[model samples]
Target chain A: MEIPVPRPSEPAKVFHHSCFAMNTRFSLVLVGLEAEQARALAQTAERHLLACERLMSRFDAVSPVSDLNRRAADEKVTPPDALWEILTLCQGYWRQTRGAFDITLWPLTRCWREHLQRAEEPTDETIQRTLLQTGFHRLYLDEAARTVRFQSKGMSIDLGGFGKGYALESVAVQLRAAGVERAFLSFGESSITVLGSHPHGPAWPVGVGNLFSPQDAVHTFQLRDASLSTSGTAPFNAAGGPRAFGQIIDPRSGRPIEGYRTMSVASPGGMEAEVLSTALLITPAEQRAELLSDFSAVSGVEIVYDSNAGEFVPRIEWKYGS
Target chain B: MDLDSPSLSSSGLESRADRREFLKRLAVLAGSSALIAELPWWSPLRVAPVAEAAADRVRLGLVGVGTRGNLHISHLLNTPGVEIAALCDDYDPHLQAGLARVKGAKGFSDFRRMLEMPDLDGVLIATPLHQHARMCLDAFSADKHVFCEKSLAYTIEECQAIADAHRGSKRVFQIGHQRMFSPAFLQALELVRNGAIGQITQIRAYWHRNGNWRNPVPDPSLERRLNWRLYREYSCGLMTELASHHMQVANWFLGAHPVACTGYGSINYWKDGREVYDNVNLIYRYANGTHAIYDSLISNKFYGMEVQVMGPKGTIEAEAGRLYAETPPPAPGIVQLINSLEHGFFDTVPIGGPSWVPDLKRDAKGTAITHEKSTDDGTAISLAAFANAIRLGVPIEGMMEQACRSGVSVLMGQAAMEQQREIAWPEGFRI
Candidate 1:
């Protein structure tokens, strides 16, 4: 069996430019703009992405997140207004998803990755110890001071799952504010936001592909002035080797969820789409609908892979809304 | 050895370690005072020397109070230990305007009277191209230093004459090629010298603007006087005014002037009875087989302006302050595995991770070469260099040569375009 590669869509009457930022490629496409104006707007959007990266990147030693990791354990630390707002939003999502989505899962992620590197599963005792280091409830937020403190040491936040959506949403807002009515912005291809309808169609057509075979679409979403985000698990390592582990760590189990699966969600808000996509992937098949009820106007689908003979077959395990 | 193409084979550095050692040696060689004296103003050691108390102040006279002259006036006013002693312009309004700006400065309708001021240590000639030769010669005759705006002279003979006269004079002679003082360009040059981009291969540059390339004149009778750039008798338009800056950078980086050049130009878009072409395209070939391709137009501002110095390993977009590696270095584990595989060993590669997803898909967008963002485009720094040189009483080492090479090369290109044939560097002309 041959895997197909996706080709670029037909060129539209849009000014499109791409740049590498925040550990992913970000693209901005503006409809009905001169080349000069489009370039200027793209520059503004790129600056906004860089600012987000500076504020949120865990790898950047000087980033605010890194500073919080270093200091929030012992004392209350007031974050920048932007970061404070994002944290508050994360807190709201955590409660809405009933603890399915958590930023404090970094400890569990680090533990699973280390054990997996040695081709061994983490011990139960190790998992329990690492679990002690995680849990959103251990985080304390002073509403009046806009400051946060960790109840336990090693409790950290990684924006890797949500930063792209936030940045894309920010760029989309800036473009709309600048009178760019029809636009499309995407971060790392996994998170995409559209400003308005397509130039020739009523909505922008976006595909949710099988994680292993990216060109094979499991589902498609028609986004009109909305955003879509996808979270998935893969069997192969980053270097293209056959590996048994995945990137999505189950916060409750303190281990990466084994199997091939992908979840895609769409909503008017970029943050809502990102949170639902990640949370639905971890929530039990029967509990996903209840978790998604907190977000209005959201649609989602879960594609689970079944090994038939020697080939992987993708099946729509569950879906919410059309 | 030709200064344009330094012989690299003699260094015998084949391995990366050896090449790094060779770069270290080159750095030491570049630091010597003897070499620094021959380097351009953009070199690392080209800092302003401490001024003597007695010779700290360098009073200057402005010859043309036009657009470029006014810009120089603004920079000079902010420059330390510099005073605007006289302003000269045949146009009464410009002279009055300059006089109004520089409180106590005297005004002159003719530059010769301005050059006659004993207190004027230097004269900055920002006049039209055709008048540059006469003003520079007169400035030299009056025993005053000269800072002439670029595309030095209208004719090749005039360029040679200016150089020849300056060679015998003790006064400093500088040109208005501000990229020489740009911090970004200097950093780019440092990268090139350190072999960050391997052997220099080619340079591609362009300047594009979507405008008619015209200056508004107060009256129709003063058209030639006000908008001299649009006329053949006074200027070569895009080639002299726009292309000269890129050509100067090309020659400065290549370390050699073009041996020959050929080009074609036309007044294609703005057919407003302008004597010079609105578009130009030229290719200059150096002695070492390196080529610099340049083009300019007034029809599209899409590309704006940039000088891309390319080599085998990477490209340095000097204007944009970015460098892109041809192939980015692989992750550390991948490098080790590749090396082990090449050596016929089967090893368990420790390359497992939470899928090493890149922050962005690596396309052609390269990394920024500069650490901090800057608003400077080198003009302010270039003016400071001029003031410092005058105060230190020493001419910049290669300022005149940079001017002559770019000035003569553009004139050659103009000659090539006008005569419909390839033009060689002027024979027997010495800088």
Candidate 2:
């Protein structure tokens, strides 16, 4: 391979801003724009972020998703077009992840949380009953009518993981259209998207920091015009004791994925990275290759905490692509 | 620290449960038995309620039967084995109003005369700023226990004098920083001590209220007496009247008083010829280089009040009673249990090199510090603590120090703002 000559970098000052939305913080670092212009761009992006929050947040009593959650179990509820498209995309990812990444497992999660808080585990009968309220397969999306209906009486959906990626993707689009070619956006530092390249390099070097020592980056990824999503699980805990299931429930078994592990994925789009990260975490190692083969130009890694050192030391156990 | 949401109704901690139940809840709020032992005020709550008898009762006299004084009257009235023996206020209407609320309690226009009342075990001083030192000193001289309302005194010299008077006395002396007894604040303190939020990085506290901080004056002649908090002569304005509560909390959580302070304040919005600032901003520097930033404004009520204890790992909004983790990692120790149950399959095996496995994030609201909505803001329990301490005839071990630290800290801030220069903690101040 021939080495190419590098282009000279701009003497740019980064303008930074952060706003809370989608239950996490969204931060922006804009290069080469004047302070005022960058502030305006950040404000515009924040507006877009909040708009996405209004569409997707289940906790909001009047959000479109909340409205659907209330009415869909009884009738075919026509969501706004934007929300419908989000649901449609969720359905696509649900199928692609082989029923692994589900938005309808909220009931099972609630069940486990309730049991954990009481220092008990759910009985088999209770798990089976709660499972009836879960599963993406139980949802019926009318493509023509732009409506959604639940096959069961208590099915609900949460876009907690997906909303960050989708909002970042939308905001990135807005920023690009507004002539922001070199920028970075992050949601809680777990979901990140970069535009063009680093101010001084060909690619932005983003890192997955050590969980215990967050300031120490354990893994670095060279990214350009890409999105990275890192997700992890230990257990569903309240006040640090009586742990029960993981925060991320396994849609198939109606149980949580076991152990302290984080899955990181880099993809060409924010939504893809977000979807694949959760999907890949739930998919078994024997099946991950099949899952990854479905997507192009994507990479991922799974990190497990090693505690034999008397402290948590993150070690990479599984990785695919580059 | 699993201070779980109680199934109790929101009528507030009025259900007088058993000692074991209270201790269990206190343990959860304070983290451990060792931690609970450090809080001397909590010991009083654990003591069994005394039988209702005049001989065994804690007879307390009240000074300044105004706004806060009336609140104290309510809490003290309900406190176990406590009798409001006397009430005093220079103002005639307040004296009459307070006298009407308590049966068999004598009324007096002078606090000095009230201090001479027979069988008055202690005196509760809710008087204006300038009177705290003299009232506390006179009450101490009368051999009475003292529970003085906060911003301990009008000036640093007075705070030192009050602390010096009460230092080694057998009589109980308590400062009315009620958050000391608040379940929500106790839970936050426990979490911070347990390193749930890692090292203390910074604390930012703010209090915002929409209306002008003023009271309707029945007569123009009594304006300064009624709204004493609005004048620099009587109070340090927002710094002493308002900021002291949060500043006390900051000092308690940080385990140190500020070594120096600087601030800026002005009568920005409400220019009603008030001698004090309508808005104040201050920064207090502790010995460890941690700075506590405090601000108060009466022009906006968007964020009513919050004492945000921030660190590298998380942030605890004490007033809102929520904890927000920085990265919110899942319970890592649970991994050991889960992996061990799996017979070390994935735990030991080297999965074929570099394949995909991933996870993501959840945006759940911050965890609640306490389930109970304490409508009294711990004032009731704090009053109970005062009564119990008097009954025990022992000074609260650290009460005088807490009073002096917060009292002097706010005075430093007030001086810093007024002089437009940094003010160091009062040198040679005794506690």
For all predictions, the C-alpha RMSD in Å is 20.1, 13.0
TM-score on 0 to 1 scale for chain A of candidate 1: 0.92
Candidate 2 per-residue C-alpha lDDT over B21-70 given as tens digits, one digit per residue, 9 for 90 to 100:
44345435444435676576777666656777877888889898887787
Candidate 1 C-alpha error for residue A290, in Å: 25
lDDT of 2 by residue, A37-100 (tens): 9989988898888899999988799999999889999899988889888888999999988988
After superposition, the stretches of candidate 1 with alpha carbons farther than 4 Å from their true spots are A1-322, B1-38, B42-55, B335-351, B354-363
Query: Residue pairs in steric clash, candidate 2?
Result: A231-B359, A231-B360, A263-B358, A281-B358, A319-B354, A319-B355, A320-B354
Q: Would candidate 2 be rated incorrect, acceptable, medium or high by CAPRI criteria?
A: incorrect
lDDT of 1 by residue, A1-322 (tens): 1122232254334566666678766666676677799999999988888999999989888999999999999999999999999999999989988888889999888887777667667899999999999999999989998899999998999988688888888888888898887776666667778888755456665666555565456677777899888776544243333445557777788777667777888899898888888888888888887776667788887877787776778898888886
lDDT of 1 by residue, B207-321 (tens): 9999987777889999888888899999988888878899999999999999999999999989988999999999999999999999999899999889999998889999998
Error of 1 at B294 (Å): 1.0
Query: What's the TM for model 1?
Result: 0.55
